[model samples]
Target: MDITPVANPALDPVQFPRLEEVEYLPVSTKYRGMRLALWGGVQLLVLAICLTPYLIYKFGGEESMATMSAWYWPVGIQAVFSLLWFLEEWKGFPRRGYAVRERDITYRTGWLFRSTTTVPFGMIQHSELSQGPVSRKLGLNHLKLFTAGGSGNLRIAGLEDDEAQALRAIIEARTRR
Candidate 1:
């Protein structure tokens, strides 16, 4: 191998074309409400897990009242965390959306730390459509798109089941293998 420098063809590296305009389409309107409910359900489950053990110990007569009081600090911290989680999830719920174009799919997500990802169809390895117990009950499905050499690029949650199926079919038709 030679350690020689090669000459550049273009005079400047920043000669790419500039964008004329930009447009973004939002996800289904029901997505935000569905996400909020899912998060609230998770917080409730976490709350129960946090309090149940201490409640059992206190009411079951396994520990003295004074000893059982030790659970307060831990439970308090968990409650605070659950409240913060609720707030964040609520605020972040409306910030997610996606778009599918001729050659790729774009998903935009996040509130505090935001990101826009575009996955080219030719590079997509495979895709999946799934519904969790809660999402299924809510008539929602999640679409996951996997690229050849990367982790899950698109994981759009809270889509209607039939819409997810249709989108999966479209992308699957464009997938490499």
Candidate 2:
């Protein structure tokens, strides 16, 4: 995929106008931040679990507990490394985002290894918006664009209902073929 930055700084703040057919799409920073926060929290929990042994041993006594405590530091360090991996994945997400432009539907998605597959309007079998607990809490919904391909479905998350439904209708109408 040929990835190019917009030379025009004006479009930097808002949407970057589609120039030509590109391989990948750009991701929103807001989503990136959320993912980072979520993963970081997870990492913190893992770290805590690893440190519990030592805290228990240190607070408890030298009575048959210090031996278990020796494993704590190693586990904590492993958790830190695991967290780093997650952070790397989160960071790479933005770069994996992509936009699809064709005679059918125009779709965009995140940069990380996510499902941003686009189906031409004609390929769409049906469309709908679904909300999970996390999504509803965040006032976000996922618009699923289904095609005959079944397993290779395309979904756009973090969209308002109006926009999702509108896009769904448009695709359904256009791709009635």
Candidate 3:
């Protein structure tokens, strides 16, 4: 049996559709609120933990004022960090979006270091929908797609429950074919 090498041809890049040109749909508006709430809750929890030592020192009737003063540093640092984190989430909310094409699903995120991920239906092994307690209360769901080799798994968060269901169904149908 003789195997003949086929001629390799150069394709024009201009003919292909640009990802930037795709009209991505913004995630649910409630997503921003949900994220903010979640972040606030986490920050509060950490702040409470950090303050425990100081609270113990104060309540235990310790005489060392310096020890209690040192605890303020952690709390102050956390306040600054939390402020920046909240600001990033608020400002970057607009940048999170997704686009579903006939062949693939794309999710774009990030404000400073932007990232876009595309997963073709052919490569998707399965898709799942998940919701955290806060997201569930906010009527939001996260769609996660697992690829064949486990390398291209993608999670698109902040989708409305209905939208996530529809996308999952579409992916299920396409993968069946």
Which predicted model would earn the best lDDT? 3
Error at 16, model 1, angstroms: 6.5
lDDT of the candidates, in the order given: 0.75, 0.62, 0.90
lDDT for model 2, please. Answer: 0.62
TM-scores, all candidates, are 0.69, 0.61, 0.84
Residues 22-123, candidate 3, lDDT per residue (tens digit)?
999999999888778778999999999999999999999884879988999999999999988877787777989999899999999877557899999999
If the candidates were sorted by their TM-score against the true structure, best first, what order would they fall in?
3, 1, 2
- Residue 6 shift from truth in candidate 3, angstroms: 1.8
For candidate 2, the per-residue lDDT at 113 reads 40
Native-structure RMSD, model 3: 2.5
In the order shown, the candidates' Cα RMSDs to the true structure are 4.8, 10.9, 2.5
Better model by TM-score: candidate 1 vs candidate 3: 3
lDDT for residue 67 in candidate 1, whole number 0-100: 60
Model 1 error, position 76 (Å): 2.1
Q: Write the per-residue lDDT of candidate 1 for residues 21-134, one digit (tens) a residue.
A: 225555666767776676778878877887787888878878787767777877789789877776766666566677777788888777666777878899888888888786
